[model samples]
Target: MKTKLFFVLIFTTFQLLVNGQGRYYKAQMHCHTTNSDGGYSPVDLVNKYKDKGYEIMFITDHNFLTDSVYVPGVLCIPSEEITFKRHMNGFFLSKNIMPDENFTCQQAIDSVIAQGGLIQLNHYFPGPFTDDNWEVGAPEIISFQNGPHMLEIWNTGTETVQTHDDKSIWDAVLTAGKVVWGSATDDFHPSVSEALEFNKGWNMIWLDTLTKEAVYNALLNGKFYASTGVEITEYQVNDYGTYKSINISSSNANKIKFWGPGHQVLQEVNGSSASFILQSHSYVRIELINEGILGMSNTYAWTQPVFLNNPLHMADNKNDIPYIQLYPNPNYGMATIDIKSRQAGNLKLDILTLEGKFITNVANEYIDKNNYQFLFDISPMPSGFYLLKVEFNDVSKTLIFEKI
Candidate 1:
């Protein structure tokens, strides 16, 4: 019997890890049904946003793709809503993207990037029956030059009919270098009442797999976060050597601003949980707020702005770390890892493949640990994305889970 395989084979070059344990998916990318004026009927708006919890629905009906009604557990995604004068919302669609009243919003964003689809800039301020005006901003027309993956920035029907919250045209197109990523919909129209656009604005996707290519690869890699009711269960980011630490939990937020660039706030925390550091920055993003309770006027949550000089991506930030936990997290197979070590001599977890490959060794030796917990079955593995690496002495960590 010869079975000597020590294991530690992480071949390089695929790093874009940002682990904070996975599974978030509560998406609703834009709305409108009856194929246009949207009152309901595309399986009753996917059974009213999957009975209010919404796993993921990108119906986006307006110009085409023709909603082929399919709802069972929900994950729709074939979108289109292109208005030539200015208003767009196309997602991973492969065809049928009609828009041409002499089309020009960069020709409907190059006809939704030539039909492969990914456009989204809906309601860039224009609704008072549209003569177009938001103090004539958004560079006053024809200025999405190229960037286009998102920018609804809260358009619950233009903030419930023209209160307008384009997030200052998404910080004037991210101070004009144009990265584009920020969305919050519920542009729902049943004449706006499923209690005024069910859940108001949403996209909290941090995908593993509910498909539609993992929800457009988590909206093409910005991961995601954009809410209205405020619920960011836990988020952690850390990188030290000069500073950059951010943590957030969220009871319903009391305040947790830390934006950047023109939306500028840098830091402000009042706390259901917040950690804040950031010495210098290029991009930041996090704004929890929550102020409205009895009067109901303020409630937000948005995060997707982390670029302190993005050389591809690395932020799973664990430096001098230990204090890991992973439970339920969409894990139907089994998971319950808890570690709090401070001085454990040897430990090694490893298990990968969220495109990084190498998978095995759930643990190794000598854990005279300072608090540890286990149990990791993953029911015979075989689901979708995964990653978990622990290591001890020189410290290293990661979680990113998902089995169901």
Candidate 2:
């Protein structure tokens, strides 16, 4: 009897250890409701996320906040996506304060700060307006430098063209020596797509407890991991600033990645897992590959890298890098390209057929660098799919566009 009791105790302790270490909980941070432009009401949206195994959901409707609702086994936090000329998200805000369009980005920051809420700059790189003429200008670079407590380094449904800009923003912020954290968001808006089951973007925050105040505190303190589809089983930053590692375990992951602005590679044959070493201070990201239908594959996990020391500092762009913007995607006939920089040089814009053949060179010029918009005449080209390649200052981006 003594031996049997001892064996039972050991087994119980082993089970508890397994459960305590490297546990994963899926969640979606940036979601919308009918209070803004979403299809479902706040309650319905919460239920949908919960049913999808999300442990937490932030109801960040445009310029509106919902009351905190506590549900069993899930958390429904009161939050809002403050939609000014630019957008920002404030989570766990006071029940009394409400966001409005009239509030400047700084004012919104101040409001959230007053309530001890956690603030994050949502999609700061490309700026949210989709019109060629709609120039909101980059989030007051100073506010980005000084205001927000955190920034969303990844947003689901964000096009590949804008991803370069996102990288640039993160690099700048990291080099500046700021005290900001990184986040991933779904930016879920039902009107954008007909599929109702597409709630996949979220940040997995590490907290000691499952309470609202505890979670918010953890996020503010930079204790979290963001994910698109993959989940992290273990993440650790050691005493050496030069080394960090992540271990991931998932049900349907084909390939795991440790990619970012560094010279890192995956070590295969390590028990069918992916691993890498950190070299630079840039945001490190992990990607999970998935097979899609119709010759269209999907890369699910889009996580931003966690910096080791002073992850908040912004980098310098002494070259006055030119900013490019494309608008009205899924276009009908013509589309616009907007450029902004401190100086201008030779520019070349090419449209390539989806079949990897050259279609046309739309715009080529030696223009001065300032805010300017140029329209590409696509009426002459056969439609279906094409890529817009823009080259300037030896840096370029190929923007995918659909002609209808």
Candidate 3:
């Protein structure tokens, strides 16, 4: 029995993380072959990975799906890197897809889903120059309804050169109320002899049975952790509806950090194992690090974020989601604003563009007991993404709504 790497997990998170029966399979989720721009052929690449101790691998050639190889012990899953205006990897795809420039990003996502595959956004961090205005920009990439949900958090091919990690971008996407899982990959594209560019990152998937179907479902459910080097011996997340408890122990990590919204470190420890009790916030993620020598950067292992079913609010009021409701949430013409809180204070309700620019004042007054039910008219506004912000007490929270 080798080290068990648990894959993506939600409802079955604890079982996969704690069950000694499960083993974590070393996976090279993304790599290229000669079929596209890689220097190594499929056979050579598969052998190279096996030599380096990868239990499972996906040879994701750019715009091409290399034939599944038949290796004795190694698992070669069908995959491809959908290189359009933006880059994405479709894992466990049944067949290769050819998307022309005329195809929209969303269309590519739909195509992958049609094949029961996962569309993971490749290194879109600092590698490419893009902004929110660009249709394929990082911001826009996450806006697609059923779009790229798995982001390449650490790409070794681009890791040593980047000024920042993709964790910031991941945090941004979470802050915007979208759920995404992180993936680390080598994106390797070198020959077997090219030691300099070989293996620097990978995804560790945990499974009881070594099968392609099990691995695919694991990745789909986010049962794995993305790592550069640090390895976790035991990871457990216990979500108890009201509060959550997280316990983790790593063999190589010297430090563990518990992070929350906006990349805030809620707790930090100096040992290999640590526990965190999360009572509030939208979600929490774990980061394990091992310090490097001579003041150099350290290695990291990032676990998928654990979202809270119920959390405390900013103030004595209620949480941003449940307590705040707008009748006809996707309003056509007129709607009713139904909102309340336990505390009473000055209120400021404003509508702003998704870019955080002030649009107009919906209301600014003092309401007794912090209860308000009024009629809101969006018929005069154009259909777009807008923010409905409520500022009361000393803290404020904003909700994104569509005016249709």
List CA RMSD, all candidates.
Answer: 18.8, 22.7, 14.6
Q: On residues 1-404, what C-alpha lDDT tens digit does candidate 1 reach at each position?
A: 22122332221222123465568888888887776778778887888789988988887777866547688898787777875566678776555667656665666665554333467777665455333622335563325444466777777765664244446556655544455678788878756457766668888888766776556656755677889888888887766546567777887888787777776777788877787766776667778878765535787888877655442211111224544545544465556565544454877877677776776766787765355556667766766657677777786756566666
Total colliding residue pairs, candidate 1: 1
Give the best candidate by lDDT. Answer: 3
Ranking by TM-score: 3, 2, 1
Window of ten residues with lowest summed lDDT in model 3:
3-12
Estimated TM-score for each candidate:
0.31, 0.59, 0.69
Candidate 1 TM-score, true structure as reference: 0.31
| Each prediction's number of clashing residue pairs | 1, 18, 14
What is the clash tally of candidate 3? 14
**CA lDDT scores, all candidates in order:** 0.65, 0.56, 0.70
Candidate 1's displacement at residue 131, Å, is: 28
Measured on C-alpha atoms, candidate 3 has an lDDT of: 0.70
Better of 1 and 2 by lDDT: 1
Off by over 4 Å in 3: 1-20, 127-138, 191-193, 294-297, 310-404
